[model samples]
Target: MKLKVIGIIAILLVVVGASCQSDDQIEFKRYYSGGSLVYQQHCQNCHGDKGQGLSALIPPLTDSIYLKNNKRKLACFIKNGLKGKITVAGRSFDDQMQPDDIAPLEIAKVLTYVTNSFGNNMGTVTLQQVQDDLNNCQ
Candidate 1:
């Protein structure tokens, strides 16, 4: 009877633990989910649904060699936007992505989604990180 009671208590603990989530986790979840919509609306046009750019016109986000190499400066790149010539996947794109195309919150969401999607799994970009990037934009 004691063994059965312990097992039941363990199960209850598991259930309760599963239900409990920290506030940061909830916010991250919200950011990640909202970022998907922002990407579809704002970015799907140039970047494509799967992040495959239009043949040298835009850069693909699906398998970002750039992101892989330049993770630190990525948020700034997003906030301040990109110009000049960039090479990705052995192809070159010479275009300017407008700065502040989306609001800062949406930028965080979009970056989080992109980093965690399309053959990339870097990590999440917090609102604080985005704000910091904005401060240090180039």
Candidate 2:
């Protein structure tokens, strides 16, 4: 009887662990999965499907150390665009980001996707954080 009880407890623990994982997966899908679509529509054309960036003209956003330090600037830069010069991975990109005017929520989604993908693990970019960042920019 004791052996049977131990087996039942082990099965229960497995089921509970699986349930917790599903919840995390749902949250991951809500942000990263949705953000991917936003990225494809707005950023993929220039930044490449994998954020590899175009040569001479555009700079890659993937695994960007500049981005890690200036996370707040991303939303503003993405929306209002970046002109002049910027450095990433020791390379200089002197060009235009071309102001996109994407919505605040879209910016958050894009940032979340960019900062979390492409060898980046900057974590989720919340809507409120984007709004605050944009407000501070101006």
Candidate 3:
């Protein structure tokens, strides 16, 4: 009876763990797809569909050096556009990030899209996270 109970418990744990894992995957997928649509609507033209950027006006998110270093700065900059010249991966972008005119949810969606895209592998940026950060913006 003891062995049977232990085996059943182990199986239950495995099943529970797998279910939780799948839920996370589904969440990520939702964020990814939503992000893609938001990007297409707000960003793709200047940044390129692949995030390769265009000339000196926009910076590519695919550049690992820039993405890693500027993740937080990028989020804040998205909230409030940066002016003058800003360099990424030794290249400069002189244009401003259009004020993320969308609702907080849309802004969060697009940020998640950029973070997950362009070969950058950051976790999803939740709407709550964006909301919290935006509350502190200047």
Candidate 4:
């Protein structure tokens, strides 16, 4: 009887594990696809498809220190465009970053991609966060 109970528990665990990939994960998959398209069109030319920087001109987003340390700054800087001096991952970037062209929703999607891809582990940037920052800027 104990052996049977153990077998049942094992089956239950397997069932639970199989169902762990839920609808939310599907949504994330979609978001990642959309963000990939956007990045390919806009960012890949300079940042490379894998988020690696173009030497001293463009900075790599694959570094976790830059993403995790300046997550909010990255979002805001992308939205508003950066000018003058800025530092990330013990390096300084002084170029002007063009403001994001897409809407708040699209911007959030792309940012989510950057935050989750390469070597980054940051969370998604919400549409509300983009909209609010844009409003505050103007």
Best by lDDT: 2
Give a tens-digit lDDT track for model 1, residues 1-138: 999999999999999997798877777788889999998988889889998878878889976677878766777776677898878888778899876566778888998899888888866788788888778766
Which candidate number would show the highest TM-score if scored against the true structure? 2
Summarize candidate 4's per-residue lDDT along 1-138 as a digit string, tens digits.
999999999999999997788876766777777888888887888889888887777888877876776655665676677788766656888887887657777777788898889878666677777677666663
lDDT of each: 0.83, 0.85, 0.78, 0.76
- Among residues 3 or more apart in sequence or in different chains, the pairs in candidate 4 whose N, CA or C atoms overlap within 3 Å are none
Query: What lDDT score is found at residue 76 in candidate 2?
Result: 90
Decide which is better by TM-score, 1 or 3: 1
Q: For model 2, what is the C-alpha lDDT against the true structure?
A: 0.85
Candidate 3: clashing residue pairs, number: 0
Clashes of each: 0, 0, 0, 0
List TM-scores for all candidates, in order: 0.78, 0.82, 0.76, 0.74
lDDT of 3 by residue, 14-96 (tens): 99887776666777778889989988987898889899888777888788777667655555677677787877768977877
Sorted on TM-score, best first, the list reads 2, 1, 3, 4
Error at 36, model 4, angstroms: 0.5
Whole-model lDDT, model 4: 0.76
Which ranking of candidates, highest lDDT first? 2, 1, 3, 4
Candidate 4's C-alpha runs over 4 A off are 1-20
- The model with the greater TM-score, 1 or 2, is 2
Candidate 3: list runs displaced more than 4 Å: 1-20
